[model samples]
Target: AFDPPRLSKRADYSGQMGGVSEGEDVLARWSDGLLYLGNVRRVDSIKQCCLVRFEDNSEFWVLRKDIHSCYHPECHTPPIEPEVDPNSWICRQCVFAVATKRGGALKRGRFARLMQIMKVRLPYQLSSLDWDPQHLTNQQQCYCYCAGPGEWNLKMLQCGSCGQWFHEACTQCLTKPLLYGDRFYQFQCSVCTNGPETIQRLPMTWVDLAHLVLYHLSLCCKRKYFDFDHEIMSFANENWESLLLGTLSDTPRQDRCQNLLNALNSHKDRFVSGKEIKKKKCLFGLQVRAPPPLSSDQSPFIAEQPINITHRRRSETGAHQDLLISTLNSVLGTESIQTPLNFSLFVILQPFAKWLFDLKGNGTRKALIMPILQPDAVT
Candidate 1:
């Protein structure tokens, strides 16, 4: 068998030309029958390479040893420069040119594949949008600006700009938890804080206040659904009307009234008492039964095991009472009041509490009534 020709050594190019000079014409043979005719734009002895600008205006880095002096009769004369605008240089071999010729869809597909292989995101889009669904599903939760889903342990601040919740650890700009006082405060996210505006403030609305209160209440009661029956609706409506008229006759009445109005308007959908029933019950008393209370196995929202009734009852008169009072104080921005406990409010909320706790009628009384009477809960 015949052997292939041995590759020439680097010393073979010595004395071929004085040296690879910048702006000097040369022919670079990268491989057999594959030659590049270009001018040496730069020579780097340290890198053992030369920056060659080809006839097509594109440039490449070729080893100095690979360059040979061109002495072709026509090569001796400098090639006429194309009469293009001096400011505008064109390179048909560039990435932009290749993408333009291949069309947008193919370019995008290739880019997407490359991003997938590299586990990276496109710079222009939100990181959240590019997250893998499987990762989100496996993790079950996510925090602000995190590319992957995760459970955030720290107290989160809601960004006024994006309305997304972010933990302090995730943001370099977030300094502290929002301070609660007699008045509302605005909070902006890390991104918005450094943006054009010095500070982006979120406006406080009655609806927003109500939503916050309701969300807290839902968490406390461990309930996802709430049905506002007739009694609750009447109590809310009465307080709302009293507030609007500025005639609510109770201590801290004005503040309480405003909070009541906010709560009522915010949860109007839950007040289903007034909706007329279209279908009448049959003479045999057929009725649609309410669904069973959520089982622990069904959702993470529900407790895995039943809470001890005795322990709950004791706490109802103790800690639970304090919780209710504090909740009312925080929401209404009021001190302790002398008004009698709002029994009607409890009556309205009883069914929901019963459903959530999976309590019977007697259990509902112990669970709800005791707590209200323990302290002057809410006026």
Candidate 2:
């Protein structure tokens, strides 16, 4: 869908006759003839191309004619929007569907994010409490499986894929099971869990973030962790089976997590599977910590600060990775889970729980919630 700019029939142009070398700034043409910022790893004067390495570490032999000196780019995004007659509306959707579907157009390139803008139907409902899945005619909707919506409407979560609404009570979400907890919130229906590539179980970013947290967890030393928090442990215990059989990730590192979870699940029969962990108090973290009551109404313990966990970096090692995986294997597969690694994971994940599942499909987050999460500082 992208066309290289200003192609010339002749190769020997006045551009950069001195030739590129390692560490010099240059733009290199990829296989598609599109130029991207890449550093010269080495020059090949015989072939009139240099071995160029892009930021992602992928290397390519880029031709001199296609190479250009680093300067301002003419366009930041591709001009891939199909040329259509302004008068014709039907062909646009039809064209995009067939083309992108068959790998003919918009093949998940650098600007694939631009595609998220297309095909999104903002559920034009007044209140989720009153909205019916029946009203969302095109997309399928699932409510809690009691065969009825309960008397009170808890918060309704929509799937990141398929744009369907779900009652949080109906889904065993690992990210945010509790109402008041500062834990991450998300939910996913079984379709997202098991369906085709079009139906994502969780947002790619969330999966990547989870893996990043795990990656850093591999670097944690025993001394950095604080007092144990059993909330995440409880949450995992309650939802272990669902997450094991359901959660999936396409990324390499994140896929390792999914594999570990599955491996843990296979050994479930050998584990204790404690019923006591289901108690809500033990499963969720961040309750208002208070001193013991001194009298009938007053408390004695004078501690004011809450035990909070934050983020940090770590050096990766074979032992560290083994420790992190073994910790998860223990936590998810057996009862010996309350380790420093587990607590560290709890904090790094922002108390990772499963209620944020629909942010991928919730188009509103990009426009609305982003401002709240990351507001510009007043000068």
Give the per-residue lDDT of model 2 (tens digit) for 191-257: 4444211312322233223222222222232121111133222333344443422434233542454
lDDT of 1 by residue, 11-69 (tens): 23234335778889986644211245799999877766789999999998876645766
Q: What's model 2's lDDT at 64?
A: 62
Clash count for each candidate, listed in order shown: 0, 15
Can you tell me which runs of candidate 2 are displaced by over 4 Å? Answer: 1-10, 14-19, 70-379
**Model 1 stretches astray by more than 4 angstroms:** 1-128, 131-165, 168-201, 224-254, 258-267, 270-379
| 13 Cα displacement, candidate 2 (Å) | 3.7
Tell how far residue 218 is off in model 1, in angstroms. Answer: 0.8
Which pairs clash in the backbone of model 1? none
Cα error, candidate 2, residue 109 (Å):
19
lDDT of 2: 0.32
